[model samples]
Target: MILAAGQPDAPLLELFLAATAGNVLGAVVNFVLGRFLLRFEHNRWFPVSPANRQRAEALFNRYGRLVLLFSWLPVIGDPLTLAAGLLRTPLPVFLLYVTIGKAARYAVLLWAYTTLAG
Candidate 1:
Protein backbone atom coordinates (compact mmCIF):
# COMPACT_ATOMS: atom_id res chain seq x y z
CA MET A 1 0.00 0.00 0.00
CA ILE A 2 2.74 2.40 0.91
CA LEU A 3 4.71 1.72 -2.21
CA ALA A 4 1.61 1.94 -4.39
CA ALA A 5 0.72 5.25 -2.79
CA GLY A 6 4.14 6.74 -3.59
CA GLN A 7 6.23 7.14 -6.75
CA PRO A 8 7.04 3.93 -8.58
CA ASP A 9 10.73 4.40 -7.81
CA ALA A 10 10.50 5.90 -4.37
CA PRO A 11 13.76 6.35 -2.50
CA LEU A 12 14.90 3.93 0.21
CA LEU A 13 15.27 6.75 2.77
CA GLU A 14 11.60 7.66 2.43
CA LEU A 15 10.58 4.04 2.95
CA PHE A 16 12.79 3.73 5.99
CA LEU A 17 11.29 6.86 7.60
CA ALA A 18 7.74 5.77 6.84
CA ALA A 19 8.34 2.23 8.09
CA THR A 20 9.97 3.46 11.29
CA ALA A 21 6.98 5.68 12.05
CA GLY A 22 4.60 2.81 11.41
CA ASN A 23 6.60 0.53 13.68
CA VAL A 24 6.54 3.03 16.56
CA LEU A 25 2.79 3.48 16.22
CA GLY A 26 2.38 -0.29 16.14
CA ALA A 27 4.37 -0.62 19.36
CA VAL A 28 2.12 1.96 21.04
CA VAL A 29 -0.97 0.07 19.95
CA ASN A 30 0.52 -3.15 21.27
CA PHE A 31 1.17 -1.54 24.66
CA VAL A 32 -2.37 -0.12 24.83
CA LEU A 33 -3.92 -3.52 24.10
CA GLY A 34 -1.63 -5.12 26.66
CA ARG A 35 -2.77 -2.67 29.34
CA PHE A 36 -6.41 -3.17 28.35
CA LEU A 37 -6.15 -6.90 28.95
CA LEU A 38 -5.89 -6.22 32.67
CA ARG A 39 -9.10 -4.16 32.80
CA PHE A 40 -11.15 -7.07 31.55
CA GLU A 41 -12.89 -9.24 34.15
CA HIS A 42 -12.24 -12.32 32.04
CA ASN A 43 -9.64 -12.59 29.32
CA ARG A 44 -10.25 -15.72 27.27
CA TRP A 45 -6.91 -15.41 25.58
CA PHE A 46 -4.19 -16.84 27.84
CA PRO A 47 -5.80 -16.42 31.23
CA VAL A 48 -3.16 -14.53 33.21
CA SER A 49 -2.98 -15.73 36.79
CA PRO A 50 -1.73 -13.70 39.73
CA ALA A 51 0.73 -16.44 40.59
CA ASN A 52 2.19 -16.49 37.09
CA ARG A 53 2.19 -12.74 37.05
CA GLN A 54 3.98 -12.76 40.41
CA ARG A 55 6.69 -14.96 38.94
CA ALA A 56 7.03 -12.67 35.94
CA GLU A 57 7.17 -9.69 38.29
CA ALA A 58 9.95 -11.33 40.22
CA LEU A 59 11.91 -11.73 37.00
CA PHE A 60 11.26 -8.12 36.09
CA ASN A 61 12.23 -7.05 39.60
CA ARG A 62 15.55 -8.81 39.25
CA TYR A 63 16.08 -7.37 35.80
CA GLY A 64 14.76 -3.88 36.61
CA ARG A 65 14.56 -1.44 33.66
CA LEU A 66 16.63 -3.87 31.61
CA VAL A 67 13.46 -5.87 31.09
CA LEU A 68 12.20 -3.05 28.87
CA LEU A 69 15.35 -3.17 26.77
CA PHE A 70 14.70 -6.83 26.00
CA SER A 71 10.97 -6.21 25.55
CA TRP A 72 11.33 -6.15 21.75
CA LEU A 73 12.76 -9.62 21.38
CA PRO A 74 10.69 -12.23 19.58
CA VAL A 75 8.59 -14.61 21.77
CA ILE A 76 9.72 -12.72 24.87
CA GLY A 77 8.75 -9.12 24.08
CA ASP A 78 4.99 -9.58 24.05
CA PRO A 79 4.82 -11.56 27.26
CA LEU A 80 7.24 -9.19 29.00
CA THR A 81 5.09 -6.16 28.22
CA LEU A 82 1.93 -8.00 29.31
CA ALA A 83 3.72 -8.95 32.48
CA ALA A 84 4.66 -5.32 33.01
CA GLY A 85 1.00 -4.33 32.88
CA LEU A 86 -0.03 -7.11 35.26
CA LEU A 87 2.77 -6.18 37.64
CA ARG A 88 1.72 -2.54 37.63
CA THR A 89 5.11 -1.30 36.42
CA PRO A 90 5.11 2.52 36.48
CA LEU A 91 3.51 3.82 33.29
CA PRO A 92 6.23 6.36 32.51
CA VAL A 93 8.99 3.86 33.04
CA PHE A 94 7.23 1.29 30.91
CA LEU A 95 6.65 3.77 28.09
CA LEU A 96 10.22 5.07 28.05
CA TYR A 97 11.96 1.73 27.84
CA VAL A 98 9.40 0.11 25.57
CA THR A 99 9.58 2.98 23.10
CA ILE A 100 13.38 2.82 23.08
CA GLY A 101 13.46 -0.95 22.72
CA LYS A 102 10.82 -1.09 19.99
CA ALA A 103 12.39 1.81 18.14
CA ALA A 104 15.75 0.08 18.21
CA ARG A 105 14.17 -3.05 16.84
CA TYR A 106 12.50 -1.07 14.06
CA ALA A 107 15.74 0.67 13.20
CA VAL A 108 17.56 -2.60 12.93
CA LEU A 109 14.78 -4.11 10.84
CA LEU A 110 14.66 -1.17 8.47
CA TRP A 111 18.42 -1.13 8.10
CA ALA A 112 18.51 -4.81 7.34
CA TYR A 113 15.64 -4.58 4.88
CA THR A 114 17.33 -1.75 3.01
CA THR A 115 20.71 -3.41 3.10
CA LEU A 116 19.37 -6.73 1.91
CA ALA A 117 17.50 -5.06 -0.92
CA GLY A 118 20.69 -3.51 -2.26
Candidate 2:
Protein backbone atom coordinates (compact mmCIF):
# COMPACT_ATOMS: atom_id res chain seq x y z
CA MET A 1 0.00 0.00 0.00
CA ILE A 2 2.83 2.34 0.84
CA LEU A 3 4.49 1.82 -2.53
CA ALA A 4 1.26 1.97 -4.49
CA ALA A 5 0.23 5.06 -2.64
CA GLY A 6 3.57 6.64 -3.38
CA GLN A 7 4.26 5.49 -6.97
CA PRO A 8 1.41 4.58 -9.28
CA ASP A 9 1.48 1.08 -10.83
CA ALA A 10 3.82 -0.36 -8.22
CA PRO A 11 4.55 -4.11 -8.38
CA LEU A 12 1.63 -5.98 -6.85
CA LEU A 13 3.62 -9.15 -6.18
CA GLU A 14 6.18 -7.45 -4.01
CA LEU A 15 3.61 -5.56 -1.98
CA PHE A 16 1.55 -8.66 -1.36
CA LEU A 17 4.60 -10.66 -0.33
CA ALA A 18 5.79 -7.94 2.01
CA ALA A 19 2.38 -7.61 3.64
CA THR A 20 1.99 -11.38 4.04
CA ALA A 21 5.43 -11.75 5.54
CA GLY A 22 4.79 -9.07 8.14
CA ASN A 23 1.35 -10.42 9.06
CA VAL A 24 2.65 -13.97 9.49
CA LEU A 25 5.53 -12.80 11.62
CA GLY A 26 3.20 -10.62 13.65
CA ALA A 27 0.86 -13.51 14.39
CA VAL A 28 3.78 -15.65 15.53
CA VAL A 29 5.00 -12.84 17.71
CA ASN A 30 1.53 -12.39 19.20
CA PHE A 31 1.31 -16.10 20.08
CA VAL A 32 4.83 -16.24 21.47
CA LEU A 33 4.41 -13.07 23.47
CA GLY A 34 1.17 -14.35 24.95
CA ARG A 35 2.84 -17.68 25.79
CA PHE A 36 5.98 -16.20 27.25
CA LEU A 37 6.21 -12.50 28.05
CA LEU A 38 2.77 -11.36 29.21
CA ARG A 39 1.10 -12.33 32.46
CA PHE A 40 -2.64 -12.80 32.64
CA GLU A 41 -3.07 -13.31 36.36
CA HIS A 42 -1.18 -10.08 36.95
CA ASN A 43 -1.11 -7.91 33.86
CA ARG A 44 1.94 -5.67 34.01
CA TRP A 45 1.36 -4.03 30.69
CA PHE A 46 -2.12 -2.56 31.03
CA PRO A 47 -5.43 -2.70 32.82
CA VAL A 48 -5.99 -6.45 32.75
CA SER A 49 -6.43 -6.37 36.50
CA PRO A 50 -7.13 -9.46 38.60
CA ALA A 51 -10.72 -8.31 38.83
CA ASN A 52 -10.79 -8.01 35.08
CA ARG A 53 -9.13 -11.40 34.77
CA GLN A 54 -11.84 -12.85 36.94
CA ARG A 55 -14.48 -11.32 34.73
CA ALA A 56 -12.66 -12.49 31.64
CA GLU A 57 -12.30 -15.88 33.25
CA ALA A 58 -15.99 -16.11 33.77
CA LEU A 59 -16.52 -15.17 30.16
CA PHE A 60 -13.85 -17.59 29.03
CA ASN A 61 -15.41 -20.29 31.10
CA ARG A 62 -18.55 -19.71 29.12
CA TYR A 63 -17.95 -18.24 25.60
CA GLY A 64 -14.19 -17.82 25.49
CA ARG A 65 -13.57 -20.78 23.24
CA LEU A 66 -15.75 -19.10 20.65
CA VAL A 67 -14.33 -15.57 20.87
CA LEU A 68 -11.28 -17.01 19.16
CA LEU A 69 -13.13 -16.07 16.01
CA PHE A 70 -12.28 -12.48 16.89
CA SER A 71 -8.86 -13.15 18.36
CA TRP A 72 -7.31 -10.67 15.97
CA LEU A 73 -9.05 -7.62 17.33
CA PRO A 74 -6.89 -4.92 18.83
CA VAL A 75 -6.57 -4.56 22.65
CA ILE A 76 -8.44 -7.65 23.76
CA GLY A 77 -7.15 -10.33 21.40
CA ASP A 78 -3.51 -10.72 22.49
CA PRO A 79 -4.28 -10.50 26.18
CA LEU A 80 -7.16 -12.89 25.75
CA THR A 81 -4.72 -15.52 24.55
CA LEU A 82 -2.43 -14.91 27.48
CA ALA A 83 -5.36 -15.14 29.85
CA ALA A 84 -6.40 -18.35 28.16
CA GLY A 85 -2.98 -19.75 28.82
CA LEU A 86 -2.80 -18.61 32.43
CA LEU A 87 -6.21 -20.08 33.07
CA ARG A 88 -5.09 -23.34 31.53
CA THR A 89 -7.67 -23.15 28.77
CA PRO A 90 -6.84 -26.48 27.13
CA LEU A 91 -3.83 -25.93 24.91
CA PRO A 92 -5.38 -27.58 21.89
CA VAL A 93 -8.54 -25.51 22.04
CA PHE A 94 -6.62 -22.32 22.67
CA LEU A 95 -4.38 -22.93 19.67
CA LEU A 96 -7.37 -23.66 17.52
CA TYR A 97 -9.18 -20.50 18.49
CA VAL A 98 -6.14 -18.32 18.22
CA THR A 99 -5.32 -19.60 14.73
CA ILE A 100 -8.88 -19.03 13.58
CA GLY A 101 -8.87 -15.52 14.98
CA LYS A 102 -5.49 -14.71 13.50
CA ALA A 103 -6.53 -16.02 10.10
CA ALA A 104 -9.66 -13.88 10.05
CA ARG A 105 -7.76 -10.82 11.14
CA TYR A 106 -5.12 -11.37 8.47
CA ALA A 107 -7.76 -11.88 5.83
CA VAL A 108 -9.24 -8.48 6.61
CA LEU A 109 -5.84 -6.84 6.60
CA LEU A 110 -4.98 -8.46 3.28
CA TRP A 111 -8.23 -7.33 1.72
CA ALA A 112 -7.71 -3.81 2.99
CA TYR A 113 -4.22 -3.74 1.58
CA THR A 114 -5.35 -5.11 -1.77
CA THR A 115 -8.17 -2.61 -2.03
CA LEU A 116 -6.50 0.51 -0.73
CA ALA A 117 -2.83 -0.20 -1.37
CA GLY A 118 -2.68 -2.60 -4.29
Best by lDDT: 1
TM-score of each: 0.64, 0.53
In model 1, where is the ten-residue run with the lowest total lDDT?
1-10
lDDT of 2 at 111: 72
Looking at model 2, report the run of 10 residues with the lowest lDDT sum. Answer: 34-43
Candidate RMSDs in Å, in order, are 4.1, 5.2
Model 1 regions lying over 4 Å from their true place: 4-46
Compared with the true structure, what per-residue lDDT tens digits does model 1 show for residues 33-54?
7677777635656577767766
lDDT of 1: 0.68
Cα error, candidate 2, residue 63 (Å) = 1.7
What do the candidate models score in CA lDDT, each in turn?
0.68, 0.62
- Residue pairs of candidate 2 with colliding backbone atoms: none
TM-score of 1: 0.64
